[model samples]
Target: MSEASKHKAYAQRDGLNHVALVCDDLSSTEDRVPKYFEIYSHADYELGKRFYFHDDDGTEYEMVC
Candidate 1:
């Protein structure tokens, strides 16, 4: 198994609440993310929106605006 899969549940249990990567342009980032990752959820807040994704190994990530 991949290292990312090993920590999949751990990350969820710990409630990791930070952006893993920050991009200058979210639209550009969003366009490229699906090529490598699977987007599972998305939410729009007062400030902006967030896109949640996971890799093949089940590692999770969040992109926020």
Candidate 2:
């Protein structure tokens, strides 16, 4: 077996589904997001809406409901 495969247990195990963030000023954050990041997609959820974006380095981020 390869060396990298020996430490693959972490990824194979179950963990938290997702992380939730609480923003004090969501509207302000939403307005500023398009100036720096690329807003790629959006969708409506049961609670509210979600905005998906990526920065210059292409790291994915989301504004969740």
Candidate 3:
């Protein structure tokens, strides 16, 4: 990625509340992401875990909550 792309990723992170990523197969993303970054909660919908992943550039985001 270019420097501009890196900057845009950080800028976009600032505007987001939480990334509600839709996954056809959560397993794939889950497997690649770290377990420590996972945020546990029962409020969002059902009683399950959510992954809080940071981009390669260090922008924080949530997955499959």
Best model per TM-score: 1
lDDT of 2 by residue, 1-65 (tens): 54223423123224532223545665777898888876666667786676665555434566774
> Each candidate's lDDT (Cα)?
0.67, 0.55, 0.52
Indicate the TM-score of model 1.
Answer: 0.59
Rank order by lDDT, top first? 1, 2, 3
**lDDT tens digits by residue: candidate 3, 1-65:** 76334434345545664455666556676776665453332124474445555555556565663
Candidate 1's C-alpha runs over 4 A off are 1-19
For model 3 the TM-score comes to 0.41
Instruction: Name the lDDT of candidate 2.
Output: 0.55
TM-score against truth, every candidate: 0.59, 0.52, 0.41
Model 1 lDDT tens row, 1-65: 65444445336525553346555777888998988877766678786777777767555777876
TM-score attained by model 2: 0.52
| Best of the two (2, 3) by lDDT | 2
Clashes of each: 0, 0, 0
Residue 34 in model 3: lDDT: 62
Instruction: Please give the lDDT score at residue 59 for candidate 1.
Output: 58
